[model samples]
Every structure is written in C-alpha cells, then in structure tokens.
Target chain A: MTITLEPGRPKPMPTPETKHFWDGAKDGKLLLQRCGDTGRAYFPPRPFSPYTGTRNVSVFEASGRATLHSYVIHHRPVPGFTPPYAIAVVELEEGPRMMTNIVGCPQTPEALPLDLALEVVFVPMDDAISLPLFRPAATPAAGRTGVSMGVE
Target chain B: MSYVPGSVAVVGAAETTHLGAVPNLSEIGLAADAALNAMADAGLKPGDIDGIAWVGAMRPQLLAQYLGITPRWVDGTSVGGCSFMLHVRHAAAAIAAGYCNTALICHGESGKSRIAGAQRPPEPATLNGQFEAPFGPFGPPTLFPIPVLRYMKTYGVTEEMFATVAVVQREWAGKNPRAMFRDPISVDDVLNSRMIAWPFRILMCCLVTDGGGALILTSADRAKDFPGKPAYILGSGESVETGMISQMEDFTSSRAFRVAGPEAFKMAGIAHADVDHLMIYDAFAHLPLYGLEDLGFVPRGEAGRYIMDRNTAPGGKLPMNTNGGGLSYTHTGMYGMFALQESVRQVRGIAPAQVPDVDISVCHGVGGMFGASGTIIFGRDRPS
Candidate 1:
C-alpha cells in the first residue's frame, strides 16, 4: 500500500523585494539580481546589492546551469517530501549559491558527486506560485561549458 | 586592541539537579534551579548577583525577576547552541569594567519534552522562511550534515572516522553517571545505527535532553572569596558569519571557528601544547573534526586521522569532550553552557572524567550550522 503524505513543505510568502524572483520561477525563468556597480550577481533575491550596498540592482534571466556544491540525503520525514530525498546547495554559474532540492535522480553518494552539472526545473505548488528545483543535466553540453558568460 | 588576559574568573558553576528528563521543571525552572545551585556553590545569595545573562527560552529580566536578582547589567546574546559561551565573554567583560561586581549566566531548554515555549515556526515572510525553509531543510539534523558530507569529500575523511568520534566520546560517557547514554559503542555500532542523513547515523547526533546550567563570574582579584575553586578566564573570543549554511565562506572549514579560536589563543598568549583539556561542542560527530582543525588543535585535514589514531580518546595525547559532550552528555538545545561547566570542572580538578595534572582547558562551541563560533580558555592559576 502506498502512503499519501500531506503537503507539509513550506511555501515562500513573497515580499516586494522577492516577488520578481518568485514570478520568474512561475514563468520558468531563473531570475537573479545583479549589481550594475560591482557587476556581481547573488541569490535569495534582495532589493539592494549586497556588495556595494546600492539599490542599483536588476533581475536577469540566468542559463539555469549550476554545480552541486554540497548536499545530504535527508531520510527523516519532512512535511511534503518522502523519506530519502536530496537536500542540496548548488553553486550557480552566476557566482551565487542556492539552497534547493536535487530531483530527477537517485539520492545516493555514488550517484551524486561534487561538482555534478545541474539544470533548473520548476515545480508548481499552486496556480499562483512555483518553486525552483534542480536535477542532473540531461546532456553533456548542459555542463559548465554551457554556462552563460553574460552573467557577471 | 591589547589582549588583556586573566582579568575575570568563573567563581561558580552548576547544572540542574536532574539532567536527562525532568517532566515537572519548566524551562525557567530549570534555569532557576541551576542558577540557585551555582550561587549556593559560590556562597552567594540572589541579592549578591548584580548582573544577569541568558539565552533562548528565558530573558534576562524574566530570569532576574524569577530569581529575585535586580541586576544592573544584562546580556541576552542568542547565537544558537553556543550562546552561553558568548555570554561568558560578555559577563567577564562586564565584571572587569566594574559594571557589576558579580554576573550570573544561565541557560535552560525543554528540548526533549518541548515543555517550554519551544521554537515556533518562522513567519512566512522572514528570510529563512522565504529562502531556506521552503526547501524542506528539516532542522539541524538535515542542515548540519550537509557540510560534513562535503568535508569528507574534500579531505578524504571516511565514514569510519566519523564513527570513531561517537565511539570515543561514548567511552568518556561510560564513566559519567549523568550521561544520557553511557553504554559502550563500537564504530560498527555507529555505522549501523539508523541513518538520519547521509554521512550521519543517529549515533552521530546529540541527544534531545531537558536540562540547564549556570555560571558565576567575578573579578580575579576577588576570586579567592568564593567558596568553590576559581577557574580564571584566561581568554575569550566570539564571531558570527552568515546565518544560512550555504553562504559559509568555505564548506570544509568554518570561518567563524578560525576567527574565534585564534582570537582566544592570542589573548591568552598560550601555545596549543599548553591546552591540557579541551571540549569541542559535539552537537554532531563531525563538529569535533571541524573544531579540531579550525581551533588550531590539529592541522587541516588531519583531525579525522588524529581521532582514528586514538589521539583524542581516553589515555590519549589530548583529551577532548571528557564529559561525553553533547553527543553522549545532555544537550538541552544551547549546549555551550554545559561545555563551559565541564571546562570549569576540569580546571578545578573536579570533573568526573578528570585528567591528571591539568592546568588549562579550552572550550570551543558552534552556534548554528557553522554560522557562529565562540572559544574560551580557562586556567587553574591566575596570571602573574
């Protein structure tokens, strides 16, 4: 028999500073804020540039390419997740790290190596919201070489 | 800043009468119990304590009112599990500056029973709720192990090495009657225990316990007046990094640990070889590895081998977590207070698992997952 678990995973309550980033995920685009002054991009979207403390920041679509920096296979029961899923921190090609889930792959040490290439995949929690998750890149061309140089 | 060493001292230290599980004691009760016991141990009354410090469930004012202490100075520096370590540093500074003649630092948590006002869920619009919480990072067990897996991959530390940390600490626990889990455990037992997260078996994690501890600080000049032996505060340091684990400057090493440890050592003017006893807060088995390396106790990437080689076990070159630590001892949420208690016991020649001829003890603690660190060095003798 299959167990049906309640959707216990927390959903982001978008703020004015983060609404664009969440909307971008709903539109299937990985949007990151870049500082026009320092030419540095960062994650967990904010209104001002962290480096320069300047409000001169704008959102841009990223290539959605990242490398698995570190992770753990959480076996304990989380609200919406089944046991034994990968909780990962992936370093985006734009030089920011993001806390996300590694989906579409087995959650094992042998399968998930450090620096493994990953691509963004959006999962819609509801009609008005979507969350960005990552999975192993489908093609060899989807690796680091495919990272957009336009970011910073 | 010129490093001033041994200006203040810990005159009294004590933990709640019952450690493992006390269903009757609320979180504030636990703190009060420990605080009163420590004051009695130092031959002090509630009126004598002029300063108060606390973290987590109880605020300084609430604790002060509950204990009948009208403190002129207060500090509530809540930096996760290591908050008490920072408290000690602040208390010592307050005493040295003549802000208060006597300062009491207290900690209490109903971590196991959740009897106290336990942590409520983060607000939906908060930074954590908006960014990291949505990803299903389930508390410290899931969040803390992430760096360990990466550290293992980066430094070639093995699963067995992590298991050894649990096994050796259990040996120390076996000697303590107050330890929550005192039975002996082998590396195989650790490896075979139910896995909570990859690279972390259940054995590697700290026990959920309901307990509390307190410390009393005063100027070193007045230390001899205390009924109990004084543990001079030779040095202290604290630092905070990013709140999110992903933003840590380095995955393999904690920057906060590096900064805090060196600052303490510099302030104390002591070499690594002078540290006769050490307590690295072991909320998880891998923490000692990071602590050992980052605190300059061992070279980088060598702490795993150092433990595997039996350098930190009983009858080893250096004794670590001699009270079984949070892994085998009681972890009442913020564990730094307990670590401080053990260091004081060691310095006063009263620890259950006491090491011979010990003059100095080092206690290092981590707050969140590599987010903040505090290091304190205590000595048996006052600086000349």
Candidate 2:
C-alpha cells in the first residue's frame, strides 16, 4: 500500500507501554525510567530496561534538561508543521536520546547549533496527549533571544 | 551452525522490463513479471520451483498462487528494503540444509505511482507512530537526513565532500542507459539544486520510481542445468539496531552495518582487498558514506574524501554503485533489490558498465532509518 502521512498535527496515541509517559506529561512532569539495578535512565519509557532486560525499573521525574545532538531543517511542508521547522534529536542529561522539535527560536541552521543546551517544555495537544518539546535552556549563557516555554 | 560459503548459487536474475514509471503494472503485476522473466532466464517454469520467498507490496501467498507454484519452504521475512538480501541468506541456508531444492525470491514496489492500495499510517500505538510520526516528518527525505548533520560535524566532512557522492554516481549512471538521470552532473550542480532538507539537495536524494527484480537460487550442483551463468552466493549476514532514528546507537555510523558487513566478509573468508566490486544501497547521499565507514571499506571519516577523490567512480580502484545506484537509477523505495541486481550483474561480468574481473562483489543495504541491515557477498566461481 502507498503510505502517506495523516493530515493535521499528529498526536500521540499512547499504548500500554507508554501510558505513564503521557500521564506524566499531562501532569507537567518529564518522567524517565531508570534501571533499578544499573541506575541507567531510558526514554520513550518501557516497563523494563533495554540494557539488562530487567523488570526492576524505577520511574522518576526528570530535570527537563538536554543538549542538542543533531537535527534537520526540513524545508518541505507536512500536514501539521510549516516548512523550514527544525526536526531535532536531543540528548537528555540523564543519558537518553529522544526525538522532539526545537522551538522558541528561528528554524535555521545558524540558529540551531550542535551541543546547544535545551530544556523540555510541554505543549498539551489535548486532554490526553502533551508533547514534550525542547527549546533553548533558560541560562544566561544561552537564552539571549529565545524565552523558556517550560510549563509550571 | 556457521554459514558456509559457496553452497548455493543464484542461477537466474531479472528486473522488470520497464523500470521507471511503469504505470500499467500494479505492484503484484510487476512482481509476477519479474518472477516469470527470471524463470525464463533460468530455463525453468514456475512448476520447477518448490521453495518461495518474497517481500514488498505483495505477500508470498498471493505471488505463489499467481505463479501457480506449490512450495515446500516459504520465507516472508520482511524487515525493510534489505529484506531481499536476508531472503538470499535464509534461502541459502534453507537450500544447504535440504529444506528446499529450487528457491525463488522477488521484490516489487510502486513507490511513485502508488498504484497499490492506500497504506495505513503507522499505528498510533506502535513505537514509530507514538514517537516519530508526531514530529511531522513527511517521508524519508526528512527522516534520513536527521543523522547527517551530526555525521558532518563529527567527521569534519564538508558539504562539497557530501555532494561528491551524487556526482560520482552520476558519472556511472551516465554510462548506464537504463539510469533515469543520465546527464553528467557536477558537485556544484548538486549543491545549487533545490534543498529537500538541510544539507541534502534534490540531486543528493534518490529518485522515486517503479521497479521490480527477482532471483532464482539452488544448490551449486544443480546450478549447472540452468541457462544463466551462476553467481555463487558466497556469504551473507543480517541485523537490526532500532525502530526509531533516535536510538541508532551512533549518528555518525550504523551499528547494523557494522555488525552485518563484518559477518558477511568473515563468512566469505576474504579480506577487504579481495573485493573486486561493491554495491552500497544509496537511498540518500549519506548512506554510502555510512555504509563505507561502517563496513570497514575505508578508515573512519574517510568515505567523504574517498568519494570526492573519485575512488569509487568509473575505472576507480573500487567500482561501486556501477548501475548508477538508487541515486541516479530508479529508487523503488526499497532500493536493496536494485543493489542486489547490480552485484549479480557485475559478478557475472554482464553489467552495462561492467567492472573487469569482479571475482567478489559485496552488496549492502539499510532498511528503515539505520534500523536494519543485510549484506550479501557474491563470487564469480564456487570456492574449491
């Protein structure tokens, strides 16, 4: 079958494996799971650890801090996004990488530098799904032009 | 059990008669046409085949019923584009272990025409639908380039170096009459073209086209009865890393490629120096770079410079993507089939832009966004 992206902003359809993640996002918390044994954190949370396959994983609130790893300045128009938005991958401080949008700044190559410090901000799509996007971290060194959209 | 090399040989291989814009053919139509052509090339009928394997827009049962083949073994292993190479690997093992005598593998995709029925979007509950689709990536043009910026920065690769891959492959394509984009193009021409994504110009991406290819394999002892010159299935390996691009292990290289390539090379019992030809699936310009580095064909971060120096161009030390690759040739979305076709052609010394004396040819492909990989090594003669 010829696959095409759906129209409009795609929302998260949380499964049993991801319900807690969405629930935590709705509550304004960036939750991550850590291996209870190894103490290593994981993202896009699952019930168990990927490294050790241990069911002993602990869910906890995160600091919402991350660093920009890589991104693409997509110039083509998709259903939900304007052309030229930054589709970014950010490395969280707790050592997990997640795909998110880089917001609160110009979506250009010059604006989004590698290793830029970032912090998570929740944009609630609906009552159930709140997408956690990242913008420049609110540090004196980084957020000169961009302001924090971090929800209290 | 360890995979022994040279037990099976691909006696027949044929691509669809019409490659680009075959609007008259549905996905199933293309696959059947290629299957029939390969059968004819092998001097056999559909009834002669006892084993069946396939992946793409259609299922094996449908193709089997359409071709009227009652098979003893059926492999529907579909991971991604490189699924065919994995099929080759499994078919060899199946044939070696006395599971099936004569095996047929097939691929067909209507990437551009979309003649096939509408495909369902990734289920919202799946890993990709919940994580990746929400990011608004329209297609591969957006998804594939996500890791390239990190690769360029980490390896100190220049824009000119990246564009050289497209340029070098175009030179090879210029010689192949079947290639879609035949005119010679320059690096600046590629850079100056329309940008699909950051660091990727239109020229750097693969052409969306319609195509299908098939192969017939059997034990080397039975291969002599076939009409086509046998390209021995020397060795093969398959592996996967992640479903989402975010968990690709490293942005600068492919973990799947690193694992699959070495396994194939080790199984083939040949050093890198022994490789006479190569076909690295180029879904995007950056793929060959990652393939080269991860496959150990070049040192770390040397692929960009290597291509820029025309090392992989026509008459270069290593003739790679000699069929113009998915970049200049037709990209049927699942480009691994075309890459396999080229490797078989070069091994048989029948490629239009044929490299001379290709004793060993390596065909490597990536499925999804660095999620899975399959490597196949083909040799001209069966190992003594």
Cα lDDT of model 1 by residue, B153-266, tens digit = 778999999999999999999988899999999999999999998878999999999999999999998999888999999999999987888777788999999999999999
In terms of lDDT, the poorest run of 10 residues in model 2 chain B is: B116-125
User: Residue-wise lDDT of candidate 2 within B250-325, one digit each (tens)?
Assistant: 8998989999999999899999999999999999999999999999989999999999878899979998999999
Instruction: Estimate the Cα RMSD of every predicted model relative to the unseen true structure.
Output: 2.6, 4.3
Over 4 Å off, model 1: A1-6, A142-152, B1-3, B56-58
Docking class of 2: medium
Maximum-DockQ candidate: 1
What's the true lDDT of residue B179 in model 1?
93
**Cα lDDT for residue A95, candidate 1:** 84
Q: List the residue pairs that clash in candidate 1.
A: none
- Assess each prediction's global lDDT (C-alpha) against the native: 0.88, 0.88
Off by over 4 Å in 2: A1-7, A140-152, B56-58
